[model samples]
Target chain A: MNALNRKKEETFKPLGSKSLLSRMAKYRFLYLILAPALILVLVFCYLPMFGLVIAFQDYDIIGGITASEFVGFDNFVKIFTMPKFTKAIINTVKYSSVQLFLGLPFPIMLALLFNELRMIRFKRIVQTISYLPYFLSWISVVGMFSAFFALDGTYNTFMATIVGESYEAKNILTDAENFLGILFWTNIWKNIGWNSIIFLAAITGIDPTLYEAAMVDGCNRFKQVLYITIPCLLPTIAIIFIMNTASLVTLNFEQVFGFQNIYIQEETEVINTLVYRQGILNAEYSLSTAFGMFQGAVSFALVCITNFIVKRVSGVGIW
Target chain B: MKKSFGEKLFDVFLIVFMVLMCVIMIYPYLNQLAISLNDGTDTMLGGITVFPRKWTWSNYDTIFSNESLIRSTVVTVITVICSTILTLIVCVGAAYAIKKKDLPFRNAIIWILLLPSYISAGVIPTFILFRYLHLMNNILVYILPSAFTFYNVIIIRTFLSSLPVALEEAAYIEGANEMQILYKVILPLCKPVLATVALWTMVASWNDWTTTLYYVNEPSLFKLQYIIQQIIKQSEVVQKMVNDSALTGGSTSVRARPTSESVKAAAIIFSTLPIICTYPFLQKYFVKGVAIGAVKD
Candidate 1:
């Protein structure tokens, strides 16, 4: 009996371990398909993250990652001491907060206003035209703005006709005082049309019977919007608001970078521009990496807090 | 419901406001068109509103006449096509793998891929790494960096996961392999999301100029948007030169009346025309795509 049991155990030994291996082997081709993307993410995305440790070191180009001496928090100290870095942080916060406070409601308002339109053809036309600018590259938009705002350009001519004073046209883009306003309003202009899309979808999704009941109760269009439409739109609005708040620390690098020039650099410079200048132009690897890590930490905290508040309040969140 | 006087007045006000908004939206492009078609010298006289004051194709002629424009256009075409196709393949494959529930290390792979979207290594580390790899000035710079847009992958994954699992189950029962079930059963059902991803990839690749602004110093590899940007910058510089010379009363010997204005306008139109034309069709999918992408878990 003992000899027979020993022969059975020996026979089953290879099959026991090989079964798990075989299950994974069955999905081998799928993994093969995913190999290229995995490699790209590792090389392009994950490797740079490992490279992020250079933020702590006194990163040197000639010595590379291995030979760089450890500096602890020196890079962060340097970043905090640099006046330009502080200005960039302040500007970024200022621009983002203004955009959050002022620019958040325009799209929803636009969506509601458009929904009130009875003429379908005209509504479609308005939507099409509104969406057109969203497709234009920032370079193109900045170019157009620069040309129109030139001293001898059409804007000045039109102003001359209206005000009858041929004072030189204001270079609004370069004016330090108008920088935040310009950024906010142009963002609204470019995105309001596109941003209203989800709101429109939400509006359409609301039951028509709610409006019918409101009408039976003698509610005017304005009252209907206030009582019915806004309440129904709040969930969508809450989600969007929370999502946007999460991104409040980050600016669109291309949008600001394309519009930037030496004249307006002081007013328009933000964290991204700072990173670009220090990292690419000056090759201050450790300092710029530290700055990026700082921005990332702040942004991550903001997103987490917003997500928590939103989840608790509205029962919907980014997660 | 019968309309009240207030309702009628409100409708009128709304219509007027919408019409005004449309005009504001369209006038910029139309203004550029008018300036581009007008004689470059005449455009300097100002007030070319919706239509050209003096019509000519010379601005477009000048832009097309440049050899760099043609080369850039060709380069743009090659990059957009190659990059879009490559991105779609990479994203779709990974998204497919991620859809499988029992795949080994699936959660970890997902976390790694999605990490970059949230936390960046900043410009310095990425630049140094890419330079080390010698990807600068190479066409791979455009294609490889964007090979996996994790956002698009998430969108596609959400779509694939939402699909009924029974279809794939039946295929598996019928002795189909994983690849077969994916290509034959799953892919056919992924049209809407696929279209959305494709259009997005195409638009992004076509519009990108920052890659060139950062890495490409070789004129031969200049993309269309980047070259157009250079033209706009040159025109601005020459415009400044012309303005300065005129101010100094130095008898500015200008060549061809500084046709830079109309040329820049023409370049704007040239670059944006294709996107404008393609927008209406893709608009159908994007509205739904964005909503689904945002609201889904």
Candidate 2:
């Protein structure tokens, strides 16, 4: 029996226990597929994160962060005291809500409408043209809008024609108060169509039989949409809402900064543009660092709260 | 239980309303096109013109003549090329790594990378970090933080994990190693999803201007969007003066008179041409890429 067992063990050893390393070698191609992306994340994403240490010190070019003063929360304290910081926080929250309200529903509405179009050609054309605006640079859009809104430009031209009185254009760009609302609406015009892609997909995924049954039951198109479409899209809507709320303080910097003016600073200022002006332009590294950390904290909290609520209500949380 | 005439009227009205909405959506773009192709003189009249008074290619000619325009193209092209390669690399690696159902810490690593996308670090800290690295003026400005969009990875990973694992096992059984199996097996199969991701990353990079604002100051390194933005601002100032001169003298400089709005229209077309031209052929890919928002961020 011992002789038979020894021979069997020896025969199995060569094929089975070659080594754990050799076992992983069998799946080596899987690792190779992953290599390029892994290395890039390390160099760029992970590398910059290590640079986050600059958040502690008074980071400067000539002095470098290490030799510069480390005032331990002083930078954060300074950020809280800045008037512009408070204004930016308020404007960001306001703009974000407006974005959520106006921007969020538009795509879903567009998708539902497009899905209902009886003519495929018209649907394609509308979808194509609507999506085209998404590709246009915010700068160009703002430029075209400024042209239309100018006193002698298109909007006022139409306005004067209707009202039978000449209205000189006020400097809307330079005016501080009206800037944020304009920013919010322009964002809607720019992003709504592109955002509709997800909702469109979610629409297509709805079971056709459910629609057929509803139609047979004497439900019209609008009723079917209210009952069938919106509820089916609830998951996507809930997700995007939470995502939107999570990043509420992070404004679209390109759009805001492109359209901003010194005179309009009170209305147009966002946390991101503020960071650019204060951190890069002014070189107040400590103040900028603290401000950034504060922004990060608020956004993080928002995300956590959103996740908790989503988990409790919908059971579809991102753990 | 039968249908009512009021309901039918409402349905017809809704359809007509939608058709009109489509007309409105498309009209502005056509107006811009007409203004672009028109000779400078008719455009500055600035009233709505369905067609150009005198059509000419001169507006596009102006864009082609300028060295700054060409320079912006070069900068924009390089950023797109380098950034696309970088994005594919990071997203593929992370996606591939997280794909293994039993891989240790896979979920944790994915969650870490994902948190950044949802909860931003804000512009100030990211800028400060860039400043600290002395990368403030570097072209790396456009490349680094954006290279690894988490949304792309999750989409790619989801697509990859959905593939037949049997093909991979079959290659392994044939005595091929991991590299051979992956190159000969998985990558060729991944063309659809990869193409989807590539198109999106390209558009994102091409339309980028905000990154160019923070990380770069050199005119030579400015992306096309930034340069186009500069021209828009310049034309705005120049056109305002032309408008002023026209009001006073009943005439304006020959170049500024016909060129300002016409050229402005041309520039918009030029900036968007690459996307418009290439996008249709790849529209099928886009439906799949919308999976980007599905995963998160």
Candidate 3:
């Protein structure tokens, strides 16, 4: 038996040790099919990662990335000193925290309410209407808001009726103080139904027997929801919460840029818009790149940390 | 079982609240439509709610007549079609390749593709790369950069793996090669997921003005959303449109002088019409797509 095993191993060794070229040729069709996507990602995604070296350089348009002078940590130090950069960070935290506190619960509540609906047809119609805004781009949402909140628009007119001609028309879209509130509310409005989908799906996946068991135990509908439904949804909620926490520093660029104006730039200047202004508008490429790298590093660290905690707590995470 | 009085009250309150929420969701679009249809000159007076006081087609007429607006609409349509098709082909192919368990370096290929989705090289690096490649200010910038999304590939691959292996094996036994098997057997089974991804790509492409904002400089390559962005951000674009209307005074009637507000509303409505028209029919697919994405995550 030992001699026969040895012979079998020796016979299979040559096939297992076949050269890469022959193996590649054997799977040429698979490789051929994958080449375009691989090449595209290499050029557009991977190659640019090498270009991040400019974040440590004094990038000039004429000299470009290759000839740019190496500046080491100077770009990072410069951005750290900039008040605008500091303000951007603060604004990002403020906006994201508001979104985290208020914006997060709205969807969960909406999902719970949706699950409580007895009429399927009405529920479907409401859900369809609610998800409509998520499909529209931020540009469209901003455009619609601009029209509705223009100086002489419907909002002002409605205010005038309530205040009886003492009401001065205000452009809420451009109100610096109200901008964060607008961001919070608009986010909820746009994403409440869509974001509730996971929670709703979780609700559906709750074992029906648990509900029947609760009914036998004389638990009311609300009690059943409180005891069984909420507990069941905790895992899904924790996973989503971790994801959201990970993205706390990264504001949606499109939404911020669309809603931003000169009047509200001070309030709405996020890291993303600041980067756009510095890099694209002012052509301060290195400074913007450094800032971008800082944002990326912080976001990655946050994701890793949150993912670790969630995995430890629940044994499930984004990984 | 019969509902208690409290439950009955809660249901009534819930229905009313939901109805109110639906109104909040929908009324903005209705208001915009009313503003768009209202006379451009009269919209400045500001009481247009759900219906136009003085109905006119001049806002849309102005939109159609403006050369830049028309060009942008054409550009958006072309980009949407080209990018959606390219994305479907690239993502489907990549997914199929990755679905092969014995494919050499399969795990390595997946990591290479997916790492970018989480850890990006940031915006400036990407912009510089585009500039170096001469994709800046080029139309290919729109279609190429977004053609191979890792998330879409993962979604497609997951769907493909869920399909029974016997289907592909049966085709292979009939003398079908890998490509033929993929084309003849696998492609037919992937319609639902493909439709979901296709809709997502089309909507994303149609609504993307950022590529134009960051890369393209040529006025002719400006997309619908970017033009609308300009109209909103800079009063000059609206002024330019008004001036263009005055220049083409012989074509349009004098009664339809477009105000900045009405023109902005009209431009917004024009861009949003495609989504608003198709979203109800496509809502289920989007919901399913989100569910699939959630399950994967």
Candidate 4:
């Protein structure tokens, strides 16, 4: 692949030296093909970026971005001092840290378990079932979970029966203590199969000859996996870990919103939801945009820092 | 190789574990289906686990009869089809253009396109932009913003770059222009990847309620998922009322009406049905597409 890229680069060097006008004329068709997407990106993506200037302004719907009064850093200062914003920041960190620590390993273990299954047909069927949840929208997943875990729902009824009628039914969805646990478990259930695909692909890429050699050396299946499979999976694992770590602040808005209720809003609120509430619902556009900008900056920093550290430590980074 | 006692025990454990995992994954949908099919009033009495106790189609009938739900369904269908077709055209065209390695300023253009995936301009700015563009409360809100994602562009570009350049060259030599080669030769070969992306866009547009929540204020413009979300919220309130009434020995008038819980379940199932029905046949292509996407070049 590197050689192919290098060869293409060599061939394109002369084209690169051509005059700008000549090159433009020569590749007019390609440029024309690219125009629609370029224009859309400019209007939607880049234009909104220019609208980020409203974060520094006291933005109102009437005056809009251009006419809004520039407040300099007042919005940022207000968000920093707000209690709700602080609570949201704390909750975001707590939930995502839990997710990062617990959520990262399950997929790797699932991939290993999947690889160990000798019956190809059973493995395929199980995989199909596992991947089913990933396709469902967060609305459906949260709705289904809410029904199952409602006070008069299936889970509570089954629990009551099992405990011989003394057990009290709990609405786990609404309970603050149990909300994070529900999020963690449901996230795992939805993503484990889909997430394991890369690791499984990596395992498949491992040389069969190494396994054959391990067998000749009388290594057990467990030992072979521990020594060979895990080692072979390190680079892919490192890359995924870095990516996950970088996005630690950005929780899935739809999932959190679907499960959110007045009873547990304090515990469930995150930056994304906070932005929606303040900006859209409360109409505090400048403050919300500042909050969002802060979140984006922190996430960007995390990505760079993690990528740098991983590159230094293991010579594997997203770059 | 003959299995030892421990290995055989391990096999049994693995099989049982896999079966249990499958059950856990599948049980929620089946439970919802049961609740949706059951008589709404009876469903509130609980213990309708895997099968409906008092079977009835009233829940679905109610959903189909509701004017707003029917409207939302139509809106969602139109949005999905329009968005998917638009995304395919724009992304495929950009991917084809980017596939030309010698295209001037290729690296700069690619970076410009890909930057948005990493850093968004946040919702408020985007909302303001939409207001300025006159896209607020418009159906085009769903179709326009999603037309260009660099991830899809890269995926299609990767697929295109992998194909033998010989076919395109042959077509070019036969007096076919670039657009003709792309339409005639390239598109025919890209069906699998295109299907994968189209399915992705379809599911995304269909499931998106946030666009409605954030952008459109007109109730007439509500999409299916947003309607379901509203139903879920309303049902929660009603459930609370039912619980409160039972505690206070109040009138069972709330109970007389078909329970909103059942209706909520039915609405959810109705909205999810299209994806569920089509996924089995298309799952392989998606799996392969995701694998290609994960290992970025």
Candidate 5:
């Protein structure tokens, strides 16, 4: 296959300068097809990347980047000294750790349990309903939850019946004690089904003959899963784990923003919201941009570390 | 594959647990549906669980009659359609060009495109750039920024690259120009992938309100999700009002406002119903699409 491909490549190579110009002309048509996409990426993505330099400057709206005074590390100093920055970083790490360590295992367990079901039709139905929340907007999810958890909401009504009339109804949304629970559980609820798909696909790729062999060896359902299924799933798990680790500094902005309120702001504020508040709402562009840069640098470092770890462990890396 | 008594019992337990899981998943939406159909005043008393006690369409009527809601619904539909087309054009074009083995700087272009997925310019600089582009409060803000989705481009490129190259070579031998080959031969074979990408784009565009939250302030440009968010916020205010009055033991003087719970529920239903209704049909393709897109790469 390698030789054939190389031979085909050789046939297409233009040798002389005249033929090279013609070859370039032919490729230019392909370039034209990609121009609009290229230009859009350049304008929106790459240009804004260069705009990160404003992190070092005292950015002013009227003067813009050109006239803004460069304040070597002053913006970073301001972010470090800000009261909310510490809380924001702590909350970001707290929620993401719970999401990664506590929340990541649920989907894998779900897929494994799902694979054990003998009823095929029932499995499909369960999957269909379970994935419904994945498609709903965060705003819709927050709306539904807010309504359900209201003071006189359905949740309170149900709780009264279960735990009796003596059960006091504290509004779940505003209760600082319940904020981490809400974030963790809601993140699991919203994502478990979607994340289960990868594991389920991996399960399907496992050879049936191995399962049969395990069964013949007196391996029970639990033993078969332990011996055959989990081993088969490790490569996929490694890839996803590394990718997720690379993104630790980032949280879903919409999810955090959707459920945010003044009462729960103490517990729920994250780094992204801090940036949003400082940059857009407070108009402190330089300080917030510095925070943004810090986030990027940390995430990039994490990606490199995780990539190295994954490569050592599995001989496969994302890059 | 015979099961022992213990295994059979375990299967029964699993089925029951799965059923409960499904119930828990759907219960919120079901509760919201009941409230949306119930009378606004009646809902304040609570205990409206799975079905409405005093059924009414007043909530739906209020939503349908609201000028901003109607306008935003129009905006959402237009935005989804326009952005889906733009995304397909950009993604397909870029993917097609990158599929060529001889394209210059192909790896560099691919790396540059994937940079956004890793590092970001955050809200401030991107917001500033959009403002400078005059996309602020403009409808184009919804359409233009989403055109170059790097993941979708990679998905399509992978799909295109995996196809048999002989078909395109045959087309070239038949005197087909590159454009003709792309449109007539290659694209026709790419229907499944294109449809999947289109569906994903549609769902994303329909659900997006963040663009409006950051870039738009004009009422004319508010999308349906943002309007639903506003309604939910209003309901929160009313809930606070009730809570405050209850704390003061003035429950007799205060009553549920007409737009408090039921109207908000109705707005939630309005925003979610279309996606839910269309989901089952798309479900068959969605699983495979995501699996192929994520797992292959």
Candidate 6:
């Protein structure tokens, strides 16, 4: 006979003689502390989740969730058949990989560099300069970029003189050719410093004893990094990589929407952005909902696959 | 002791690379600053370089002259204040509750609170929910919908777990109630980590445009981020129209003269200056705080 091992069952069983109500009374204030926040979380976060049911139905604004016609596979079918949808799905995968691939390594490198520093002030300055952009919204960063890169922008001006005067910034995002790289690089530029933070933490968590031991063994700084630092960071690197893989299908929609234009729409489009444009902008409720649900499904699959792999390999996973 | 050639070379390389990157990073901002100071022929500021061809303070003057900008700044400040307070209150409460070893329904509530981050219910459903709750376009709409995030809850919980139980017990024995302990003993000692969380919450709430974009269309309620976004979108629309008109030889020409691009840029720099200005104050903790949340596994 198998029974579920749940917390509620465990809690009551251990202190069986005590009345459940009285036991609750004993810790009443903790419950009181939690009550307002718990209610808010329930009402705002958990409740909105119940509305995911619309994914299974043909949602109508006027008709609402109840009156909406129920058609499951049809919505999913439209999503798969749509060209833009496929592009979005592919773009999301490619962009996330680009982000994780190019974006993931620098932090570990920085952490190693930072940990090597004997001079604290110089290290602080480097860290400060590096993470400056992480605080700015995507909007601000993009504004800064477009100002210098537009048709008459400095970047194009520099290129125009060198390349016989044909360069332009305005067409970069709209050219269908150069847009994806622009989006990818812009994202990297914004996040590189912020991403380095975790690696620094992992490095700092390492025991100084290891370094002292390595130093006593006459291992040079480079050798110490290769042997001691990199190996210590492996677990963290593995975890971040797995999490990145899990979210590979969910690109940052808000950032993409802010930066992308119509020409790049086919190339730079992502599943999240597609959901917004199709469902919210175009008012194709069922189709967008289906695409969103499909995205969720893919991300879930990715997360599970990552969890399995990480669990097997490193004995660590998000779950 | 004299430094070796290798060490000297490495240091030189590091400084050059760092300074070069800093220049690349600040170049765009310097360009924006130049545009803000330029007027007349530079009014368009279109594709202007790292320096203004025509320089004046009129652009900055115009921005300061906007009553709406001033009002929105005040509103943004108030929201940042309130949202940071409310978020810290809820986050500290929930994190403390979750940290209780014997608390009833702890794990269940923790999972329930966090489950929202991973799952996507789609935006329409969320929009409809907000609509139903009578929160659509309300000023509270911006603060309430995202008052507590699961990601934040997890981080604060992690920090709280590292707190010693003996301290809380000592406070309890001294006749300080749970609230008193949270405020006096736990909170005051939590200052460093609290400062980190406070900085993040403020920056995030200040930079947020998604909530405002979806839930609101009112100019009066537009946060700086949303205002900058709308202005950019308008400029993009105009840019697109101008191109279309030029292609078809349509009789219409834009009198706005591509100034929207520069204006959008100006608006962004202005909106962000406050948060960006605080970055130096909190920069010390960025590495530490992110280091914690970055490795959830």
Counting clashing residue pairs in each candidate, in order, gives 0, 5, 0, 0, 0, 3
Local lDDT at A267 for model 1: 66
Docking class of 5: medium
Q: For model 4, give the interface RMSD.
A: 1.0
How well does candidate 2 reproduce the true complex, by DockQ?
Answer: 0.40
Candidate 2: deviation at residue A260, Å? 1.5
Ranking by DockQ: 3, 4, 5, 1, 6, 2
Candidates ranked, most accurate by lDDT first:
3, 4, 5, 1, 6, 2
lDDT of 4 by residue, A148-192 (tens): 998779899999989977898888777788878888899999899
Best by lDDT: 3
Q: Cα deviation of A186 in candidate 3 (Å)?
A: 0.9
What does candidate 4's lDDT look like per residue over B54-166, in tens digits? 87776666676566788999999999999999999999989999888878889899989988878889899898789888999999999989988888897899899889999
- The lDDT for every candidate, in the order shown, is 0.82, 0.72, 0.88, 0.87, 0.85, 0.72
Pairs of residues clashing in candidate 4: none
lDDT of 2 at B203: 90
> TM-score, each model?
0.91, 0.87, 0.97, 0.93, 0.93, 0.88
TM-score ranking from best candidate downward: 3, 4, 5, 1, 6, 2
State residue A162's C-alpha deviation in candidate 1, in Å.
Answer: 1.4
- Among residues 3 or more apart in sequence or in different chains, the pairs in candidate 5 whose N, CA or C atoms overlap within 3 Å are none
Q: How many backbone clashes does candidate 1 have?
A: 0
DockQ for each model: 0.58, 0.40, 0.78, 0.72, 0.66, 0.49
Interface RMSD, every prediction, one decimal place = 1.7, 3.0, 1.3, 1.0, 1.2, 2.4
| Lowest summed lDDT window (length 10), candidate 6 chain B | B249-258
Where does model 2 exceed 4 Å of error? A1-35, A50-53, A169-174, B1-7, B39-42, B119-125, B128-137, B234-262, B292-297
Off by over 4 Å in 3: A1-9, A19-23
DockQ of 5: 0.66
| C-alpha lDDT of residue A304 in model 4 | 85
